[model samples]
Target chain A: MSELTYRDALNLALKEEMRRDPSVVVFGEDVALYEGSFKVTRGLLAEFGEERVKDTPISENTIVGVAVGAAMGGLRPVAELMTVNFALLAMDQIVNHMAKVRSMFGGQTHLPMVVRMPGGGGSQLGAQHSQSLESYFMHCPGLRIAYPATPADAKGLLKTAIRDPNPVIFLEHELLYNSKGEVPDDPEFLVPFGKANVVREGSDVTVVAYARMTVLALQAATELAKEGISCEVIDLRTLNPLDVETFVASVRKTGRAVVVEECWRTAGLGGDLAHRIHEACFDTLRAPVRRVAGLDVPMPYSREIEKLCIPRVETIAAAVRDVLAASV
Target chain B: METKLRAVLPDHELVKLYEQMVIGREFEEACAEQYTKGHITGFLHLYSGQEAVAVGATAGLHKDDYILSAYREHAQAIVRGAEPKRVMAELFGKATGLCKGKGGSMHLFAPELSFMGGYAIVGGQLPVACGLAFSAKYRQEDRITACFFGDGAVNQGTFHESLNWARLWELPVLFVCENNFYGIGTEVHRSSALPTVHKRTCGYDIPSEKVDGMDVVAVFKAVKYAAEKVRESGRPYFIEATTYRFRGHSMADPAKYRSAAEHEIWKSRDPIPAFARRLLDEGIAAEEELEAIRKRCTATVQDAVTFAEESPWPEDRQIWEDIYV
Candidate 1:
């Protein structure tokens, strides 16, 4: 294992995939010469040349639509939307064409492509820029969504997404880009979809989260441990092919659960997880399934208020404490 | 370089074009008949009067050249070499359909024929066509992508974006706008600030022109010239084929919005009979031979209907099969 930032891990994944397959191509706004606004595509143009690594116009819909066509024309295109918020502009292509192509065309072709977007609401970018739209993607069928919380999963899941024979939505958190971690040096390492990782195993209560929220959940688990309360933090690596079984098994063992999500409370992924946990571990539960989701409001601009809107370590720990203190 | 009508194409080739047009006409008529008989369902957009645009443009293209079209695409697919029986089966939602009955009428796809697909959304196929051309250029292939859409699609954001990108990338794309005058019920004058579709491409620095969509030879010649220029220059070219549709926008439309005089004027220039008259006047084919070709087209369509009726429905388990690889 080697220490690398989340951004570098993603860059390494792109470089390795491009080197492994000539069919793989990368393009987006300022992805080539600019090395990407986020620098995730740094050195890709130098390594792959302009033929494979391209800088496209700031046309989000066409960017995705072109990727759909390129995938149909036998090229594995990894398109970046700059950010998840801009993906709203390409919703027509994403929802109408990319998601519907294979099924609508009766499986005549496969779209081996990936759409990478950096998303989350913590950097004080305000409502327009700071939005967690994973629920939107999870709501749509014919799409696989991966939001890695660590550098290791970033590299592993990205490589898996590149090799996947269907469209994948790869969400990266802006805050986690600078965070360093020990990532496996193996270029062949792949994180399979539909499997949850129990980050900190415990027997008291199960805490389920993913992406940036997973980091907070881990922190909350550490804090809960100080109070003599053991919390099992299950990091959901993928949203669509959700590893409910892993979390459900954890809920059965712990006899309590709390789902943490960064998106708005209503229609959030946490609600879905809470429902599933209740359904799967009804008899085994000590208290009701709790959901610690972001407040049902657009992300505010001020840091203090924004902190209140998103799920924090304190909020997660409090929810875990509530579930543990509740009478059966 | 204006060749006489007799010399525009050889006798055999001219007759072949006429035969394809007849086949397209007969196939759409059969689809209409099948729709009423309850064999075909869904949004059926017939290409009855706009045959020449699909037939002529497809004939001008090399077999390896890719083709993409909108929902009104049966003629485009058939002309691009998709078997009529399979296309009909797709319309019938049979398991043996071109798309295995997954796409139905508006999404026929034949990858082997390089017929990319039939996009249901207006202007949805433009960027995809650009991407196909980009792939060809990136792989150092000498093929171009022919994208067909209607006048209604010109106002879509994708149309403008695709044209700009295609020109900026110098990709080989032949944008064929079949101006059937209406986007469902909205006429061109009401929908577009500038109703001339070809002129809209001037903003993108892409060269474009207009042709008589009712004349098969005109569309064929214009597309042939434009496609060659696109292939040579590695840039996109636009052609507005001024055509008319005899049928309603869809099976449900009664076409009450159109005036009788406008329909009559367009009907007089019906491509099939007009091309037949030119063929007879030019001594390309005898009356008996032309009549025989029409009968053959009729039989082929009938055979396709029979095949679609005999084809089986897709299994229930297969619904979840193709969403991923």
Candidate 2:
């Protein structure tokens, strides 16, 4: 195993995939020369030819549409949309064409394409660029949604997404790109979708999250452990074909659950998970499942106000403490 | 550069165009007939009067070239190698249909024939066609992508974005705008500030021309030239086939926006019968031959109806079949 940041893991995955498959190509704003806004595509242009690692115009729809056509024409395309907020421009291609093509065509073709978008709202980028669109994509069928927290899971899940025949909406948390972890050095360490990882096993409560939110939950779990509170943190690696059984098992065992989300509270993915938890583990639950989520308002430009929107370690810890208090 | 109509396409080719137009008209009428009988369901946008746009343009393409169009594409698919029986079955929502009844009439597909799909979103096919052209060019294939859409689609952002991208990359895309003057209830005049659809491409320096959509020979000549330019230069070319839709936008539309007098003025120039008269007047074919062509088109459509009626519904288990690979 080697220590790598989440960004490097993503870059390594692209490099390895491009080297393995001649048809695999990467493109987007600054993805070629500047190596992406978050530097996730650093050194890709050097390794792959300019034709393969292309820089596209600011047209997000065209970028995705091109990837869709290229994928249908027997190429594996990883089209980065810069940020999830910008995905609104290409929503037609994503929802109408990419997600529906294979099924609509009656299985005549497969869209083996991946759309990477930096998501979630911690960095104070404000309303236009900071919205988390994972829930929007999760509601749609004919798509696989992946959000990895650690470097290891990032690399493994990305490779699996590249290999999978469906169109994958890969949500990369902008905050987690700088976070470092010990990624397995094995070239073939592929992670399967619909599987949740219990990062820190515990007995009292289950905190469900993915991507950067998982890191926050982990930090809260660390503090909660110090307070003699055992928290089982479940990292939902993929949200669409969700590993409900894992959450069900955890909720049944712990008898208390808290869903931590970086997105807004109103009609959020956390709400969906909380509803599922209630349906599956109602008798087992000692307290109502609580949600520590982002404020249901547009993210402000001020750093302090932006911090107020997303869930911090203390915020998650407080939510877990409330569940603990309720049980007592 | 204006070649004689007979010189460009011989007498036999004219007859074929007539037959294709007739098939398109007859097929659309049949769809309306079946829809009324509760056989075919969903949004049925009849290409009753816009038949020449498909026939004239598809005639200019090789079998290997790609064809992408908006929702009004039953005629385009028929002109481009899709079997009539399958197309009919598609409209009928039968399992034997082109898309196995999943897409109904709006999303027909024949990748083997290089006919991509009939997208429902107005300008959704623009970028897709450009991407298909990019693939063809990047793979060093000499194929061109003919993208067809209505006048209403020109107002969409994808149209301008795709035009710029196609020109910037020098991709082979023949942007065929069948400007039938209506986007649902809104007329082209109501939508576009500058009404000429072909002139819109001038901003991107994509060469374009306006063709008489009612005249099959004119549409054929213009599309042929545009397709050739796109193939030769590997750059996007635009052609506005100024046609008219004889029927309402879809089966349910009342067409309350336009007047009967205006419709009559255009109907006098209906492409199918007008071309048939020209075929005989130009000494291309006898009146008996025209009757024979109509009989043949009727037979083809009749066989298609039988195939659709007999075709089975898709199995229930197939619902989750092709969403993923």
Candidate 3:
């Protein structure tokens, strides 16, 4: 194991995958000479050359459509949208082409491809730039969604996503890039999908979250621990192949749950997760499942107001406390 | 005196082209019959009057060249050697279909034949075609991609984006615009800024041409030249085949928007009989031989219908299959 930042771990994953498979190619706006808008593709052009690493025109829809075509033409392509919010421009290609190609074509071909986007509302980038569209992708079938919280998972899950035969929407949080952790150095190391990681083990309450929210949940677990509130923090590695079994089992043991999400509250993924927990562990529950979700509004530009919109460590801890205090 | 077409291809090859066009016409007409009987469901876009574009273009390119098309692609698939019976079964939603009944008329795909797929959304296939060409170039392969769409797709952002991307990368992509003059009910003049579809490629810096789509030989010659230019230059080329569809966009349309005189004018230029006349005049084929070819085509389409009727429905378990690999 080696200590690395979340950004470096992802860059390493891309390098390792490209080195391992010649069929793997990378492209997007500023992905080649510029390294990347976020520098996640740093040193790729130098090592892989222009053929495998290319800087495309600012055509989000075409970027994904070209990736789908390349995947069909027997190349594993990884495309990057500048930000998750820009993925809306490519929704026609993402939902209709990339997701539907394998099944709509009657299993004739598999799209071994990944579309990476860095997103989350924390830095007061305002309404358009800072938005969590995870639930938008989750609503669509025939897609694999991976959002890793820790540097270790950022490397492992991305490697697995690159190697998977299906199309993967690999989401990276904008705020977690600088956070450091011990990542496995094994080039062959791969974290499988549909498995949630228990970042913190406790018996009093189950905290379910992913991406940046997972970090906040872990921090909340640490804060709650001082008050004798043992909270189990579950980092959901992949959403589509959601390991509801892991969280359901945890909720069953704890008898209380708080589902945390950075997206809007209305029809959010938290609603779906909370419903699943209630349906599975209703008989074993001490209280109804609680949710800590982003407020329903376009993100505000002020740092103080922006912090209030998304989930924070204090808010997560409060939700866990609220869930524990309630009785069935 | 030998005709220009006689100099380009042998007698048998010329007859084969006529045969393929006949098969396309017969198959589409059969689909109309089946659709009326409720054997085929969903959007049915027939390639009736535009048979020449598919047949001529398919004949123009190499067998290994990847072909992608819009929803009006039954004729393209058949010309590219997809078994007519299986394609018919696909439309019939039978287990024996090309896509095992998963992809209906709008999404026929046969990878083995290098027939990529038929996209329902207008202009969706353009970028995909560029991608295929990009892949071919990246891997140092010789294959090129031939993408076919209608005039309706020209207004789409993907059409411009794909064209620009293909040229910027200098990928081997032949953009064939089957300008049937209508995007559903809207005429080409009404829908486009510059209704001359071929002229639009100038914005992308890709060389292009317009051909008489009613003349199968003209379409074949233009596509043949354009496809070779793309392959040799490792760049994109565009061709706007000026044709007209005999039917509405799909079965749902009544085609009341088209004038009766315009319809008659295009109908008189029907490629199948026009080509047959050329063949006879050139002494390339006898009248009895042309009749025999038509008979053979009709029989083939009939067999496809029989195969589709007999084919079983896909198993219930299959619904959960193929979403992931």
Q: Pick the candidate with the highest DockQ.
A: 3
- List RMSD in Å for every model shown: 1.2, 1.8, 1.0
Against the unseen true structure, what C-alpha lDDT does each candidate score? Answer: 0.93, 0.89, 0.94
For all candidates, state DockQ relative to the true structure: 0.82, 0.70, 0.88
TM-score ranking from best to worst? 3, 1, 2
Score chain B of candidate 3 by TM-score: 0.98
Query: Which model is ahead, 1 or 3, in terms of lDDT?
Result: 3
Model 1 lDDT tens row, B1-325? 5355665678888899999999999999999999999999998999999999998999889999999999999998998889999999999999999999999889999999999999998999999898889888888888999999999999999999999999988899999999999999999999999998889888999999999999999999999999999989999999999999999999999899999999999999999999999888877889999999999999999999999999999999998989977
All candidates' chain B TM-scores are 0.98, 0.98, 0.98
Error of 1 at B110 (Å): 0.5
The 10-residue segment of model 2 chain A with minimum total lDDT is A66-75
Which residue pairs in candidate 3 collide? Answer: none
lDDT of 3 by residue, A1-328 (tens): 9999999999999999999999999999999999999999999999999999999999999999999999999999999999999999999999999999999899999899999999998988999999999999999999999999999999999999999999999999999999999999999989999999999999999999999999999888988999999999999999989999999999999999999999999999999999999899999999998899999999999988989999999999998888877865
Cα displacement (Å) at residue B47, model 3: 0.5
- State residue B52's C-alpha deviation in candidate 1, in Å: 0.1
Per-residue lDDT over B149-267 for candidate 2, one digit per residue giving the tens place of the 0 to 100 score: 99988888888889988898788999989999989889988889999988988899999889988888888888778878888898989998888999999999979898999899889
For candidate 3, lDDT tens digit of each residue in B1-325?
Answer: 4247787788899999999999999999999999999999999999999989998898899999999999999999999999899999999999999999999999999999999999988999999999999999998988899999999999999999999999999999999999999999999889998999999888899999999998888888898999889889999999999999999999989899999999999999999999999999889999999999899999999999999999999999999899999
Which of 1 and 2 is ahead in TM-score?
A: 1
